[model samples]
Structure formats: structure tokens, C-alpha cells
Target: MKGFAMSTVNIYKEFTDQKVTENVKKVSVIIPNYNYSRFLNERIDSIVHQTYPVHELIILDDCSTDDSRMFIAEKIKTIKDIPIRTVFNETNSGLVFSQWQKGLKEVTGDYFWIAEADDSCDPHFLETLMKPFDDEKVVLSYCDAARIDDDNNVIRENCQDLYNMFDSRHWDKAFVTEGSEEIKKYLSVLNTILNVSGVVWKNIPGLHDIFEEAKNFKVAGDWYIYTKVLEKGSLAFSPKCLNYYRKHTDSVTSSVHCDIEYKEIVSIEEMVAQKYELDMETYRWQRIRRSYMDANVSPEVKKKKIAWVIPYPGKGSGGHRTIIQNVNALIRHGYECDIYSEDDHRTTDEQAAQKIDEFYETCAAFVYVGANPRAEYELCFVTGWQTLEMVRKIPAKQYGYFIQDYEPWFFPMGNEYLIIEDSYRRGYSPITIGRWLANKMETEFHTPAQYFDFCADTKIYHPIEEIEKEDAVCYVWQPEKPRRGSELAFRALKILKAVRPQTKIYLYGSAVDAPVPFEAEKLGIISVQECNELYNKCAAGLCMSASNPSRIPFEMMAAGLPVVELYRENNLFDLPEEGVLLAESSPESIAAALLEVLDNKEMASSMRAFGPQFMKDLPLEKGFAQFIRSVDHLVLHTEYEQPKAEQIYTRAPYKAADEFRAQALDILYTDEVSSTDAAPAVPSLPRRALRKLRRIAGRGVRMIRQRIGKQ
Candidate 1:
């Protein structure tokens, strides 16, 4: 039989080689077995008869107590034409570590298919599963599966419920009719579900490490593995049921008979909570446990607590300036505050110390904000570089991310993604300084954010009475970054200088290497005290951005100077009508906008006057209040409890009270609840009636399966 199988394998190889190169056919199926020889032959037969021919089959058996190893060895010997390799594990090392790890190590195929010992696949499973891999973006793929009983009868068809399996915005349309809008929605939803065995990852840089990390996880190992894969690339799903998932009385999933199967189900939730740094709510804990067991917890129980921590910037950078102004305003308005930063080393800066001490009197606490090895805080408020390092270390219920600008660009690419990804994964409520930053957080990072305009000390930034409209002054500290679009401003200013020599361009910030093209005032870098003077002397400020909607427009406006704003066409925020002199990227366009503002004294005057109104309307205090409210709403409305009538009324105050009243009344009258008298009356139905109901259900299932087959 072995000799005959080898001859058959040679013939098939010859036939395949004559027709097509094996390189075009890339998938290999690996089956790892332990014991249970009863199903070994059928599992191998299923693979041999697959419509799509895979490159090879590698079977590794752990020394089984039963004859399963012998049966698999016999099957391999019989299938000589197909390249087959069999290795026997000296001892049973368990399914995940021994059999699966051995297969992972030995398999040389581009993609691997794992067919479990008891589970079998349809003839077309390999062919269908491999189709999605044609697209390079598809790093992982999985097909819908059916739950089969011991006799191979499908107890439930379409058992791969991706929506229920993963906590993602995608999955609602996973099983819609193909090419339809519903199918798109399903794909969108399925994109987020991480199914490890159902997926085939390319031999990328991090694949092995991901698998190893997953093996280390005691529970929710599959989720940990799949999520790592998803972070690297996109996922694809097949609606058709190719694999049959064995549902037995003695299966590992079946053995975990907890109220909520913590070993199996709780891992995903726990992983999600830890990843996002979310406070595990009482209802969420109960719901997770309840999925596996009929366990109950009190609704009134408080599972987690939240604290708001903020890092104070003591220096006079834009971030610190805003924080100081806001803190003072809050303190004056009777809101309790706290201050934390690197220890105040400059005792001579009397003004800074006075402000700090004044704040300290009203603040709940004040301490140096740094890596505190011994201290633990529930939350940390952070700004600038401190946010990148300190925020993650603090195990906080809520994070108040006060983003003043798109600061990530200042860091390297990988570091930028790390900061953004961490914030997004940790579920921080970001309070952004501008609309552009807010939209980027929402669209790119998929994190919820609210926009608040930067606040200035109106007393410091008041209009300069002695200043007169002469020449437009362009002041930028670091004008090298592409996003700043400073080079465009330079070109425009050069043209404007030629057209009007009297115009003086004052360049500030970092300019160590680059030479000034024009005879301009090069104040390499200025102190905070000098920034106001620059604003006071300038007739109009030059502002430009390729990506960010910068604070310069608002800053110049507050200083009673019209702004020549050169921005990208797809600006996320709407520009001010009168105060902003909008310019395109082209030098000609920038010059044109600059000339218009320069030539029209009346328009410039109106813009300068309109600037104060814009500042007044968008005060930081009002914006901060709105930010607090938005955070409150998100925390309150997050899906913790299954919405009760009272919860609905409280959470959704916009809904009419009468609507909730009617709903409450309906719930009270529903048959879902039973009285003590009704409980005694609710006896089991007669045997004949119960049998009749079961027969009807069985008939319905059969009819549905037949209909599906016909379709």
C-alpha cells in the first residue's frame, strides 16, 4: 500500500508540474493530532478531497494514549503522492504548546491552515479561504463556521458570530449578501474581529513574536494573538461556512462551566479594558460574567473610581501660558484646582511664584509631576512632552488630554504613532486647542475629541495704541517644517518686499543654519516678554500651515493685527470672515492676499476691530466648560448597564420624560417578570406538549437548512 501510494503521489506531481508551477499555489494545510483515532481518517479524507490543491500536508502527532497516532501514521503512508511529513511528540505537551507549536515551527508554506483533530472542513474550504489573501493588505482572513455535534450533525449553522466575538465598531454587516451595501457593512464590522485560526498571516517581521506572546497568555490567548496581527495590517472575512467547529460535551470551552466562563470569555474583556485603560464598571463586569453563567450582581455596586489629574506647565510656552490663564480663571470662578510640574527652581521669578502660590491656596493638591516610583495617582493632566511619558504610567479612570497643537510631528514617525495609538487605545477624552487637531484625532485616531480655542491673557495681549499700519511683519520661531508652510510665506514676502520695499519682515524662532534671503530683522529666538512687543509693533502677522490650523490667527487677532493666513485648501476648520486674509499655497496667491490686506486700509482696520470680537466669543473658559460637559456625558452614557427605563431617562435627557414614563409602565406590565403566585403556577409543560414543540423546532431547522442548500 505504501509503494502504491508513492507511485500515485509521483504521478500527481508529474501532472501538476506539467500543468502549472507550484509557486502559483501557495497554501499548505497542517493537521496536528493527539488521540481520538475515530475521527483521524475522516479529517485526513476531508483534506485529500479538497477542491483546491494545497502544496503539501504536514501532520505531527503527540504520543497519544489512544490509537490516533497509529491511524494518522497509516493515512500518511497511504497518501504517498502528496508530500507528507509526520513527527511524533515524545509526550503530550497540550494542544497549544506541543501540536500547534510544532506545526508552526515546521511549516514552510506562505500561509498556514490549521485543521483541528476533531474538526473537518468542506471540500472548498481552502480555495475560498485563500481568495482574500490575493490583496496585499489582507494580513489575516477567516471563514464562517458551523457548530457540529458528535455525529457531525450541525447543531447550529453559521456559528462564527464575529459581531459577538469582538468588541469593534465593525461586524454588523459580516454576513450580508455579497457585493451588496449590507455586505460592505458586514465587512466593515468584520474588519475589527480578530480570529487567529481563521486567519493566515504573511511571513512578516513580527508574526512569530506575536504567536509566542499569545501562547504566554493563560486565557484569551487567541484574542491577544489576533489583535497584534490586526494592528499590523487589515483583516478579511468569508461569509461561507468552510470549516466545521466541533461542539462536544468534553470540549475545553464546554468544560469551563463558570457563570461567565472567565477563562474563556473574560480574557477578551480584560484585554480590552487593560489596552484602553478603561475603568471596569460594575455592570460591564456582571454582563461579561453573565454570558457564561446566570450570575447576578447588584446594580448599586460601584466597581471603579475616577480622579482628574493635571500636569502644570510653569514656563511661559504657549501651553504653559494657556494653563496658567485657565487655572487662574477657574480658581477665581470657585472651581478647585491643583498644580504639578518639575520643581520650581527659579525662586527669583516673583510673578511666576506669586501666580503659583495664589493657585496653591485654592488648589486641592500641588506636587512635582514626574515619574514617581512610589506614588500612585488615579489620573494625570498632562501637556507637551510630559504627556508622552507620564500619562500611561498613571492608572487613571479618565485622562484629560489638553492638546494645544499637533505636537506629534515634532517627534519621529514611530514615536508619533506610539503616542497617538496609546492615547486612542487607552480611551482618553482629548480636549484639543483647535478644530484641525480635533478632527484629526476623530478621523485618523478614531478617538473622541472636543475642540477648545487657545486662551490668552487679554491684559497682556491688548491692542498697541502707538502702532500704525506700515509694512507687514512675518514672525515665526521655527519656519523650516513643511506643515508650517513657512517657505511659501518666505516666497510671498520676497515678492511683497520687491513690490513694497518699506515692508520689513522680522523672522523669529530657530534659524541657525538657514540664511535670511532678504535684509530682515533676524531675532533668532525671543523670550515670552518680547512676543507681545513683536505683536504690538506689527501691522499684520504672516501665518501659514500645510496641516495645522495654528493659533497664530487667533493670537494676532487678539493683538489687533489682521492675519495673512496661508493654509491648505482642505482646512478642517472654517476661517474667520473679516480678520483672516486667506491665501493659497502658490506664492502668487499668497502675495495677492497680502497685497489686498496691505492696499485696503479700511478692510484691514475692520479686520483688526473684528479680531477682538472673535476672541471674546470663543473664550477659553466657556470652551473648557463645554469640554467638561462632553467628558461627563461620555463617561455617563458609556454602555455599562443594559439601558433601563430610569437609565434611559437619565442618560438621554433630550428624550421627553413622558416617553420614559410610558416605557416604564409597559415594562412593569410585561410577562418577562413573574409574581410569587405565578412562579408556583409556572410548572413544566406535559411531556406530549414538550415533545411536540421540540419536533416542530427540529422540523423548522431542517426546512431552513434545505432552503439554504437550494439557495
Candidate 2:
């Protein structure tokens, strides 16, 4: 069916001062179509069956050469009741320009929607999309989109984690609240702007001007438009998949040229940067340049254009070692390299200064590795253990959060909000270490990120001693917290101890004086010099995480030791199947996994052989290179990186509370009827007046009935 048309009268103007106006409730859906005749009908049908009735569908057909026009003409005859207006373009016009100029001109309702012809939405899409606009500060609203294949089967899910959208603390708090006020509060803190199809934008001041300026841009138009809108007001987001974004072979998104798109995107982004008064153009350019490097370009050209930056060398934990190895690998390749750390103080008595000095000397470039108030580093590289508070103090062009674990969990409630606020405010771009974290960052924070898995130095972590067939060794870093699966590990060890008393269990990391619950040896924290020795002698490793992926699995694999892993459902990252045992976080499951790994010699040997190869596959050098490349691309593609709103009012946490409340009241009272109403109805008197009138009429009727009885 053809989409709805704009109302004849100026609905917005008529209801501008109508406290409780029906216009506020009405939605104008603008579906722009080119030539996807096959999917256009289904999309229109979905819109027709919407649960919310106060809506008009506006369709713009951009001079399609196919049967799209015929399809629309035939469908419009059948659906006569639904207000559908069809606009045919005389000549071919690009998607962004056509929508910016003609689409805005045709829009007559309170908000405008862009439902592309190939995409479809759930019946409740309008209801959910409109909820955010209840607060006036929420100029734009978006919902998660479900990814569907050609057959309409759900090929993938696009559920957003709240952590990625707001501060970690705010997300945690938002999920725990029972009131709508809490949701509104969190939305104010993390002003996410994107998901255009899932969004409904209020026709506010400067919106038209912003669209007109961006009308001529072919690629990155949506990005530019959203960035501009964010400058004017806050954004609200729904995690629910109200819209379906179809992936087809002939989609414009898939066919666009990288260089051409990059150039246009860069130009627009630079314009935005200047307009917004942001000072992050250099970081933006670097990100864009990396994208060009990854595109179909020559290797020599890429090497010359995009240089790699690595944090200086240091004797760190397994995680830090991986980082150093990765940097070394990139340097080995034909890429320009620079390293930054502290000055040469390795021989000094102070441990921190000595470490910094050693780190600096080993790399190409090195500065002090602390809170640098004056450092002009383009990007601040942060390790998992580093404090986000300290990272915020640094004046870097961009911040790269290299998380090895769910490190934010360590902070007190509301602290993560501060950290995320600082990063975004400073125009930093996040780069996570794994798929799980990357997905979390993208969906929840509304920040784009790349996943660079931990790469191991296979040269250091390898099988040096012969495997003892009779003995199975279990390594425990700590046997305390349940989240670490320590309780389960202890239970499994007890069972294994009873069954195979000779099996040795080695505990590492923390020092414990408690009596042994089972036949296990406790090895307190050891020097780095002795870690490799212990790993080489071990037959297998025990790896576990309550809600996140751990690095121990990869480390064990590198040492040719099969790993018995406790699987948690929330962990969405990928793991190597071979040499890794997946078990539920239970005593029985843990025991079973341990038994399988210890008893099966052939399986153990297979895992031992597979470990080295897996380590080789995820070399630190390759992952680091990929990371550098990703950062480069992001810089190039982004036009202007706007500071996150959270930082603007972070010092006064409740600074926007009054403003938010005021805006909410305006949205609620602006319409002629309750914004929740589905259709037009007769006006009703105040509840108090209606109740009094009904009582008075009942009394008069009662008195007349009594007189009749007396007669």
C-alpha cells in the first residue's frame, strides 16, 4: 500500500499552544523508496497495521525505473481508508538530498519518520518510538533494528546493552529502576543519537536549516544530520527491536565506493567540527585515513599514509606482555612506529620510575606514563588496570580504552558514568579488546569500537617440558569470589581429590592461609621470572569468569596446556574450541570437564598441538595492526565528533533535573488531548466537576422516588 499523506492544514501550528493537543500524538511516517518493488509492499502493509492510529504515512518514490510505481498504484486502490500520499520524482535524485528537501516540505505532523522501502517495522514501532518524545529534551528517538535475511527469517539479533549507551553506573541503575522517571533520568545522561528508521524527530527550530545544509551530501548524510540534531537536544533510545533492517545484495550501503564515501564523509565531518566548535579534527582525520588503508588500496600506499602508534615496552602481566608483543609485530612490518612511556629511570631505586624508564628505552618514543597535564599525545592508550579517572585527566586528542576484562565492574556505582562522560567529552574513540566488549560499547554507549583480541607471544609461552601422562595439574589464580568460579573450582577439586588423590592442584596469584579444603598446593604470588616455568610444567589450566571472557584460556593454550573453562551465558565473545573444555558453572560440570581433560591422553595431545597454532593465529602483532587500522578508518569516516552530553553537566550531577522536568511537562501539555490517546474523542469535563454533577442528579431522583412512595 502507498504511505500516508501530510495533513492539509498546518497541524503543528494549530496545536502549538493547545495544552493536550491531538497533533502531538499524531505521527507522520515518511517512507522514501527507489526501486525495491519486492519489499515495498510488505513495508507498507506493516505500517498500515500499526496499533497507534494518530499517524499519516508519506511515501516519496524517487523516479524508480522498475515496477515500484505500478506496485504502489495497484496497492493504493485496495487500501483506501489509510491516508496515503504518493509523490513521484520526475528525475532521479539521491536519497539524502531528496529526503532533506522534499521530505521535510511534505511533513505536516509533529514528528517525521524515515522508513526506507526495503525495511519493515513491528506494529508497536510507533508506540515505542513515540514514548521518548514524551520529554521535550528528547528531540530524536530510536529503537533497535532486527537484522533479517532475504527469506524473512531472523538471521541476527540487534539488542543493545544499556552499558554501551550510557555510563556503566547509569546503565546499571537504569535497569534496576521501576519508575519511568529513572528511564528519563538516564536518557538525559547519555544522549545517544542514531538509528534514524527507529527514530522520530520533533520538527524543532534549526532542524530544517540543518537538513537543508546537508541536502546535497550523498554519503554520511545521516551521520551529519544526527550529529547536528544532537547539538540542539538530547536523544532517547529503546533497546527493543521495533524495526527490521533487511540486508540485500543490491543495497546502496553495500555498493558505495569507499574513497568517494570517505571524501564526502570527511568534508561533512570537518564542517560539523568547525560548526560545533570542537577541536578534534586531527583525531577525526586519522580515523578516516585508516579506513582508506583498509579499503581496496595498495599495501605501499596504506603503509605511507597510516602510521602505527604503540605504547612503550614494559614487564607486565600476561595482558601487558601481549600488548608489547603486538606492538613489536607491527614494527616488524613496513609501518611507521612510535612508542610512548616514561623517561629512562630503569636503574633508579624507585620501582615506578625504573619501570617507566625501561619501557621508554625499549620503544621508539616515550613520555612519562602518568597523569600528563601538558602532553600533546593524539591518543591516550589505556590498559585494563589503569584508572579511567587518570585517563580523563590526560589531554589527548582521542582515548583508546583497551579493556582486558569487565574492568568497570571494579568501580563504585556511578563512577563508570563519569569515566564514559570524560572519554566522550574529550572526543575519545573506544577500541575494545574482544567481540563481547565491542558489541557492548557500540549498542549501549552509542560509540563505535573495534575488537582486537589478545595476542600471545608464542616464543615465550610454549611447551618446554615433557607432558607427564599420570599427573594432571590444575591452576587456580584465586579460590575466593564466586564470580571467579572459585567455589565451583574448589568443589570440583574436592571431588577430583577424592577420586584421583594423586592429581596435583596448583593455586597462584593471591596468598591464602586458610586450611586446604582439598588436597591442593597453594602457591602465592610469584615473580614474573618464575611464571613461565610454572606454566611450562603444568599439564592443564583451569580458566573461569562469572560474567565476562577471561585471558587465561588463551594463555593456557599458548603454553600447550588444555584448558577446562567454566562457561557463562553472558559471555558473547568467541573462543577456540580445540584444547578448551566448556562446562557449566557447576561443581558436577567442572568435575566432568576436568575428568575428560585428565583421562583422555589422545585428546590432551590433540589440544597440546592445537594450542600453539591458536596462539600463532592470534598474534599480538596482527591484532595490534588491525586495531591501528580500525582507529584510522574511524578518524576518516567521522565528520565531527561531538562531546557526549554527560560531561557537560557531570560536576553538577542533578543540574539538568529541572530542565528535564520542564520539558517533559511541555510535551505532555502541548497536545489538545492526552498524548496517549489513539484517536479523536469528545472533550470531557474535569473529573471533580463530573462527579459532583452525577451526585446531584442521583439525589434529585431519589427525592422524587420517595414522594411517589408516600402517595
Candidate 3:
């Protein structure tokens, strides 16, 4: 079957047996009323006094508390020429489509008009709309509409002109076009048919199933039903301005929430795209343009929107936590924010939204897992190196970068590293998470950057009690990740164990499946509360990173646990004090630092006293304030390009390509993933024991070389 581009001439040719007759077509005028008593008389008069003849009229009252049922009952006494049937619902069905279904089942006419209770049509509405059905292929015919206020004064002259702004082909001219072609081009994007009162549909068996399917949707049911009915035959457009769509504060469409409506539109478009195999790029552009138009915002009062393109937040990731925090902070300050991720990590939209609600419960930022619908934000912020490439293809007024760490260091000194390094030089204003990164970007790349301090949640990770401290050492161990210096930490822990064999060892952050040379308790992938409890019990904490400092040290300090880490530039920039013992990346240096904090009680006490106070000083609010100030500076200082039609259309194919790449990668690299279900626990060794093991291994190698020389 042809999905989209069916011809009207062919529709008529196929139905040649059902020949058109000279007699006038019987019309069923369905008036579904609900509390529109003030306009009911006018609506009834408009239909009964049509210039053309009607065969039957059906009036359904959806249990309105208003006097509409009584009003309609009395008005029927005056309409003697047309056969009329009246039914008052016992209770409200809560859906307008339900009434349409009821009226359709009883109607015996060749065509049906759902004349809404609050709207009125011109005297020639039925006559003008029914003329196109002269050809048996015309299953649906609708006229252009005039928007009117509650008092019946015209608000806009022609609604079709605004509807046709994006496509400029069909509504501007009258045509009896194929149903599939009409839906593929226009109706797939948005409901071009302005009102139910303006439409006249043929009573076919296919329309019943369409109405049933439409019942699943509340806000965009009419649009869905219109698309399905059009697939049966052809659509006829009458440019005669014969219908007036009434806009009021209390109407059903006006009362529904805006997000729900947009979400429903997205759902409908996805269903249509899969069914018809339409050009996804065109559909994507249409979704965005339609949203901009549907916002109906005047140019004067519109606020700017921003989007953050980041990776999917797999379990136990500090990067994901920081991104969520930044987004929530921006949203709290009245900036509308949205998050888009190329990889969803096998998460559904509902599951992602729920997780977002759990993390930043106060904010209502949207999370899109796959292809981002047309949001048309004023600014786009790229949060990761891979996302920088995707954001380039996404349409936005201005672009910026959210730099947490130098991403090139995550890879080796090769092609991937160079590509990631080039991402920083894309001419976007950079927002850094720490002062060291800010200074590095400005000095090396000549990119003037805005920087914010890293902070921990003291409310969740605070000193519990003096009694909670135990003789246990905690380590943030992520073994598979080479950048965390897991081997260095394990060697140091081995040394610490030999010197202090009585101390208990605990590990968290991830689970381990591989064999390790030492023993420790693996409390894998824990919640914030459990993590805080573990930190409170431990006397000292170990955190190592080859590049920037990990968030684990700050969190450990918030729980009053003294931390030992590599004395890298990134760590020295933040924790160059007595609270955190610093050492070189060598196993000996790390082991000595860990032993100093673990063995000396007075030094441990001094560090513990300073830990919580230092973390308490650098709260999330301080960082958020800096971030907002930088965003405001850029938004006010930078000039954004005006939106153009060609830009939006040209950039749509990138998302499709990105989706293909993500799927191929998922198939190829199945093992190198950190999904929540498959994450492994990481193990660690003690401090002084690491030195003994190294000496033993060195002696064994020397003995083997001596034996080879004798041979």
C-alpha cells in the first residue's frame, strides 16, 4: 500500500462503482455540548438554518451542570424540517472524543459535521464544505477559519495563513488532494484543521476504528483522528472563510497543560513517522516549527531557553551528578533548561524523567533519551567532547561549553585525544568547574573562561558523631578505569596493610569481578546515605586521579574523614592544606602519606577537625551563583544570530546519523560498558604491604636472571 503520496484522481478511479449522484448528499450535523449554554442557541441556529439542506441532526449533552440540555430540548421544538435526536449524558465522560464516537455510531448520513457547542459557522458553511464531495473519493473536506473571541468579535482574519507559514503550499490554495499526501506533508507536523466545527468527514467503517484509537489521546485526539480518516480516501480543502473558532480562557484546549500537549504531539508524530516511513529530518524540523508557532508568544515577552547536550548518566558517575546539579541550579534561577543525551543507557523516557525528579526534585527540566524534538532553545551548552560534535548539528541561536575536566586526558596521546582537545577551541565561551581548569584553558588555549568551585552536599555528607569513628580505612576504587590510578592506590594500600595490619579496609564506588592481590570489603554502588555512613566510620580515605581531582575527596571531607591523594596541580589548587595529605603519584609516596594519617592519632585528629569546616565553606550555592553570573554575562554580552529556515532544515540529518553511530557502537563494544546491572565492585590493598610485595617480586626476577646466566 502507498503510505504517503496517494493521488485524488486514483482514489476516484478505484471507487468507480460507487458513482456520484445528482441528488444532494445527506449531512449529519453533530452538536456535542458541554456547559456552553450562552452560545448554544446561536450554534444550533447556524446549523439548522444552513443554506443547504440537512438530512438529520444529533445533539449530545455531556452532563453539563449548566442549562444547555434544557436549552437544547426547547430549541428542537422549533426545528421541524430536519429530523433531530437529543441525548443527555447521565455523567461527564471527561473526553470530547467519546461524544464524537457516540454520534458517529448513530449517524446514517453520507457526511458528518461535528459542530462544537461554543462555535458558530457562516450560513453557507455546510453548502461550501459539502460541494467537494461531488467526487466519491473526497472523504474529508474542511474550510478556512476565522478566530473569534467569546463576544463573537473577530480576533484574526484568517487562521490558515498562520498555519501555512512553514509549508506554504496547500492551505493557501484549494485542492482535492490525496489523503496520504495531505497527511505526509501537513497534518503529520501539526493539526492544520483549525476546529472540529470546520470539518466534515464521511461516515466510513474505517473512521470508527480511527475514533477508537483517538480515544487514547486527550489533547491531540482530533489531529490523530483527522490523519487516519484522511488515509481512507482524499482530502478536499475549501478556502471559503465560513467557520469561526471561538477562543476562551475556559476551553478544554486552553486549560490543558502545555508540556502534556507538546509531549502528545511528539508521540503522535513518532507513530506517524514509523507508519508512513516519512523523512525524519523534515518531521523533526516540523515538530520544532510547530512548537514555536504553538507557543503563540509575542516577540516582546519571550524568555530565552537553553539546552545541555551531555552523555547518559549511568550508575555511580560523578559527571552525571554534576550535570544534573548544574541544570537544576540554572532552572531554579528562572532559566528554562533541557537535557539531551545521544546514548540513553537503555533507559526509557519515563524512567529518565523519574530519575531526574529524584535528583533535582524541585526543577521540571525535560530529559530526552533519543532524538531531541524541536525545542528551538536560544542557547546550547556542550558538556562533553562527543556532545560537542552533536551540538554543532543541533540548531540554536548561540553555543557555549561546560568544561568540567580536560577531556583529552581521558584518552591516550593519539587521534582521539587530539579530536577531544580541538573541541575546546570551537570559539564557544567556556564555563569551567574549577579554578585550575579555568587558568589552564585561558593560558594554553587563549580562551577566557568563567570558573566555579567544586562543592559537596554537607546535608547528606556531614559529621555524624565522635562515637561513629572506627579504625577502618575507606578507598574510592574504580579498577577498570585506568585514569583513576587504581594500580597506584592498590600498591599504596598494600604497604599500609603491612604496617597497620589491625586496621579494617573498605571499598566502594564500583564492584569488582577480577582477582586482586589483597583483601577488602566491597560495598559496591551505594546510595548517598550509605556512602556517608561508610565515610563516617573510616579514619582515613584514599582518592587518586591522574588529572583533575575526583568529587570523592570533597565528599569524604564533608563526612569528616581525612583524605590522601596525589599532589597533582589539580588537587593542590583546591586542597593544599592540613586536612588532605598530598603525595606524588609514586606507590612509595602514596603509601607514606596514607600511613602518616593512619598511624598518627594527633595528626588524624587535627585533619578530621578541619575537614567538615572546609567542605562547609564551599557549598553548592556558591558554585551555582558563579555559574549563573557567568551565564548572564554571556547571554547579555554575546550577540545571537536570528533564526532562519535553512539552518533548522539543514541540521536535522545530524541526529539521524548520531543515532546510527550510537547503535553501531553499542553492538561493537558490548563489554566496555558501565551499565547499572553490570557494574563491578573494585578492590584495594593496604599501605606498607605494597613495598614488601614489590621487593619480593624484584628478588624473584633477579633469581631468574642469575639462573639464565649460569645456563
Q: How well does each candidate superpose onto the true structure, as a TM-score?
A: 0.40, 0.40, 0.52
Q: Arrange candidates by TM-score, highest first: which order? A: 3, 2, 1
Per-residue alpha-carbon lDDT of candidate 1 for residues 439-541, written as tens digits (9 for 90 to 100):
6777778876766654444655657787554565765745545566666566556555655668777877554546443446777656644666777777778
Cα lDDT of model 2 by residue, 579-671, tens digit? 677775545456656777778889888998998887878765556766666655554453323222111111111111222222222222223
Greater-lDDT candidate between 2 and 3: 3
Q: Over the full model, what C-alpha lDDT does candidate 1 score relative to the true structure?
A: 0.54
When 1 and 3 are scored with TM-score, the better candidate is 3
Worst 10 residues of 2 by lDDT: 647-656
**Mind giving the per-residue lDDT tens digits that candidate 3 earns over 66-184?**
88878888999998989999878999999999999998987989889999998877777777788888889998899887777787666676685667556565677788999998788
> Which structure among the candidates has the greatest lDDT?
3
What TM-score, to 2 decimals, does candidate 2 have?
0.40
What's the count of clashing pairs in each model shown?
Answer: 16, 25, 23
The prediction achieving the highest TM-score against the true structure is 3
